[model samples]
Target: MERVPLSVLDLATVRAGHSSTDALLGTIAVARAADDLGYRRFWVAEHHNMPAVASTNPPVLIASVAAQTRTIRVGSGGVMLPNHMPFVVAEQFAMLEALHPGRIDLGIGRAPGTDQMTAAALRGVSPYLTVEQFPDHLRAVLALLGDDRIDAGPTARLRATPAPESFPEVWMLGSSTYGAQVAAALGLPFCYAYHFAMGSDVDRALELYRSGFQPSPRFPEPYPMVSASVIAAATTEEAIYLAGPSRVMVQSLRTGRLGPIVSPEEAADLDPELPGTQYAGTAEEVVAGLDDLIERTGARELMLAGTVYDPATRQDTLARIAKAWGM
Candidate 1:
């Protein structure tokens, strides 16, 4: 089988004993490691009002990561479109593309990335836009980035400045079929949130994307990428041990009691079977699992999303995976 390109998605998770600054620094360290290891892109996530996640603003984090790394693409794992105006999103990413031409990606999603109250706070009641308006908003952003498909919208009267010499690579991010349909109709790359959804509807969604796709100027072919959780260690036992914290994190998210990531020992004691799908094991085992995932999903790229308590250990996990994957 052909080798699939790999990328990294970081949440800048705040570990139990660390401050937000530490988490941010740790993310930069991971970006540098990914750059050196030849990872295709380094993307940061946006989650608001989450005590465990520090990446609330993706454009700012993208700028920081881009400044600190060389030759690695930097972007948002996504910026949730419902929380901000399409023009603002376009301008922020356009400026980023101008600063780091050919090295920026503008991943967009429809979810608010936070609880309802927080989402409401982000977008006030008056003049509020519904989630159903996401396609229009997405088209606005695309048109602002110079996509010709949307030439007569309100955005046509405006431009996202400092108009980049080249536009950022735009991707649609979702865990289900809504995003797939929109991306297919618009002819944009689609990234399935397999890491978060744990493979639910992934195959069906990708199939829907491929079958319904219409060719856009920028992307003539359907590009489906899977974002999955991964953990690599010297031994299978060690990898499972390291994945404990993520298990606890997922449990917390399910129960709405979000908190900082705890130590694996603490996590093991808290919840033994909190569900998640991770390609966790020794490096070779992880590689095999990833190959199987690619075969199942027909994904052209893989974006690994692994969160651990220790930042250095996270970097080591990525390095091990890269070495085993022969990248």
Candidate 2:
């Protein structure tokens, strides 16, 4: 069968309480496995101080994961741009592009990637980085990466050697309409955070993006990618069981209950059952959801993220979903 290009988002494991080092190493293994399985992209999320997530440093992790795999594309599900200096981002990603060549992606977001306290820790005395500065930061980063300035930095002097003859593909990651607008204005590919937000007006968001899409030096046309929260298993019941912890986590975010990630078993026991859930189902059901999503979002590419708990099981779930989607 021909391969359907599917990308993965690694927060990386959903197993509530493992050590960060272990989870990080495990995600590398999973990426290697997914690469071997012909997965399209393996992207890591930028989450700060989240006890449940191990991918705090996307660039470092991207390098590690990229070093461990071949063929599969690796990039950030997002690097919260508001937290870092754009030139630094350009330099780091340029390094990854140099090393990996033709296999790196740079998906960016406007949010701080954490709550106030955690944000303070990362930024420390720096003025709060808000959404307003996002566009400027984005422009600056791209300029450093692609612009031919008179006095370019050392890296920029040579168009940053090994620059793939092109920089990494830049994407805007959003959970709301503003992000859609920004991505559209830049004409770059947009990836929605349907995985967590389970947004109510998905269609409206897409409409905004397509309608506002303006060609930039970065994106010349409208290209959209979507990421979703999918839990696939042999059966609906099994998947739900696996999704227990994550469901609780989502509900926690939805309801303002915050802090550490709970184990799947703990979540299943504590939360009982989720109400009005969005991403829980069997392979067949999830495939149906993806089809509905494609029509509703008008997405050119779709990536299912936060899909499974265990590394091995995650691969199995993707394999099954790929078959079901006829990809």
Candidate 3:
């Protein structure tokens, strides 16, 4: 089989002893590297009230990264659509598309990207929203983006301003079969969050997406992507050591105690178990694992999310992965 295109997903992780500013800077550096390496896309994630993650506002970060790099499609790995009005999301991405032209993606997700209380604060209301409303929210966003006609309150006939002739590509992001079904039903691209959903039946989700897919003007065929956590180093032992901090970060998140990502030494003390979503090994091992993942999920694209304590190590991981994949 032909090798699939590789992409990147970054959380702009704030490591121990580092400020959020440092993490954001590191993100730009990573974006430049990914662009130079010929990666297909560079995506930033959104998370609120999390000290470990610095990418709370994906559009702002996307603008910043897009300014620093000339290529490598910049976008939200996704924006949690439930946290804001669909109109605002549409305007923001429309502006981004107008500025960047053919290099913007608007990956949308249903999760709040934070705890219930924090989500309520972000949404400026009591927390009552559910993921079941995602399809409606998505449709509203599309309508505002000029894909459909919806009654605009007060300004009942206005379209989202600066709506470029070419709009950003929209991809649905999810960790469950429901997201797959929604993407297939809507005829949009689907990106499975395999990096975070360690135990999810990704193959089944992709199969469901393919089986239920209905062709639409935006997508003539199903375009499926899978995101994974990877750590590629010179050797398997070194890779495991390099992945220590990420393991600790995952454990903290799992336990609802998310905080600054720790150093390798601190992570070593915790000795957290490696999550199934993560693959920490030599470049060859990572390549083999990625091959298996592609075969199983039949994903046309692969997104690598590597959150390590050191920016240099993270860059090295990307470099090694790119070389192994011959990108």
lDDT of 1 by residue, 23-76 (tens): 999999999999999999999999999999999999999999999999999999
Candidate 1's C-alpha runs over 4 A off are: 126-128
What are the clashing pairs of model 1?
Answer: none
Candidate order by lDDT, decreasing, is 1, 3, 2
Better of 2 and 3 by TM-score: 3
Clashes of each: 0, 1, 0
Model 3 agreement with the true structure over 234-303: per-residue lDDT tens digits: 9998888888888887788778887898887887788998653288898889999999988888889999
RMSD of 1: 1.4
**CA deviation > 4 Å runs, candidate 3:** 130-132, 149-156, 274-277
Ranking by TM-score: 1, 3, 2
> Candidate 2 at 228: error in angstroms?
0.9
All candidates' lDDT scores? 0.90, 0.76, 0.88
Best of the candidates, TM-score: 1
